[model samples]
Target: MTKPRGRGRPKGGTDSRSRILAAAIEEFGERGYEGATIRSIAARAGVDSALVHHYFGTKADLFADAADVPLRPDVVVPIILSGPRDEVGERIVRYVLESFERDDVRRRGVMLLRTAVGGKVGSPLIIGFLTRELLPRVARRLDVPDAELRAELVASQIAGMLMIRYVLGVKPIADAPIDELVARVGPTIQRYLFD
Candidate 1:
C-alpha cells in the first residue's frame, strides 16, 4: 500500500495522508470522478502529484479510500455478508442512506451518480468496486447463480433513487423516509434474491 504521505503536514506533520484523502473527496465530489484528476488532487493537496501516486496506487485506489469505504476486500466483504438474508434491502438501504448523510460520503455518493450519467473517465473504478466488493459479497450469501447481476441491479435502483431524491432534488422520493423508501423498493430487491 502506498499509504498517501501525510506525516509532516498536520500536528506539525503528522497526518498528511488523511488530509490528502479528505481533499480528494472534496475535489472528486465537486468535479465529478472523471473531471477530478490526479493533477487536480495534487494541486488541491498542495503536494506533488507523485506523492498522490505514492500513497494511492492509482486514481482508482485513491477514489476507493477517499469514499471512506472499508477499503480492503476482506474488510468490506464481511460487512455486506454480515447482515440478515431476508432484510438485505432494508439493511442496504439504511447503510447507504446513512452514508449519504455523512459529511464524507454525502457528496461523493451524489457525485457518483451525476458523473455516472454521461462521463467516461472514472466509471471503471466505481464499477470495479461494485463488482469486486459489493457483488461478490452479495453473491456469496445468495444461492442464485445470477447473484452478481441481481446485486448490480439492486444497487442500480438504490443508487438511482439516491441520485434523484437527494442529489437532483427530485420531489416526493426525496422526502420519503427509510421505511417508506424500503417498502416502495424492497419487493423488487427481495425478488432478486429468491426469484
Candidate 2:
C-alpha cells in the first residue's frame, strides 16, 4: 500500500518558486491586493507560508514580481524622497522622464499601462501598489494636513500627463521635450505637494 501524504506541502520541489508566483498572480487577480494574504497565497501554491516569505519578503514585493513591475514603489519612493525638499517636484518629474528614455523601460511601461487600461487582471494589483504602497510613503513624507489627499492629487496629475503623452499619444504634450515638460509641470507638482 502507498503511504499517506504528509501534512504540509510536498517538500518544496524545484518548481516551487514558479508555482508560488503563478498562484500569486491568480490570487492577486481574483482578490485584488487588500483581500489577498500570504497564507492564502501559500496555501494556493501548496507551500508553507514561510516558504512564500522566503521567496518574496512582502505582499508588495510579491505583487511586483507577479505583475512584472519594472520598478518597485518602495525603491522609487526613496529616490523621490531624497535630494532637496524644495525641488522634489522637479526631481520626481525628471526621474520618471529619464526612466522612459530607456527603450526597454519605455516598452515595458507602455505594456503595463495598456494592460491597466484594458481592465486586465493585474489592474487592481497596480492600483493597490500605487495607492496603498506608493502614495502612503509620499503622504507620510509630506507630513502635512491632508497629506494623503495631496499625494493623491500629485499622482493624478502625473497619471494624466503620462496617459496623455504616452498612451493617448496626444501631441504637443506628447511631442514636448522632457525638460520642457518638467519645467512646466514641476511647479504644479510642487504647488500640490507644498503650496
In terms of lDDT, the best-performing candidate is 2
Worst 10 residues of 2 by lDDT: 113-122
Q: Judge candidate 1 at residue 185 and give its lDDT.
A: 80
lDDT of 2 by residue, 41-147 (tens): 99998899999989898987887787785677777887787778889999889888888778556655654565465554457755886788988998877767889
Per-residue alpha-carbon lDDT of candidate 1 for residues 120-177, written as tens digits (9 for 90 to 100):
7557657777877777887887778888888888878887888778777877988788
Candidate 1 lDDT score relative to the true structure: 0.72
- State each model's CA lDDT, in order: 0.72, 0.78
Each model's TM-score?
0.67, 0.64
Model 2 regions more than 4 Å off:
1-66
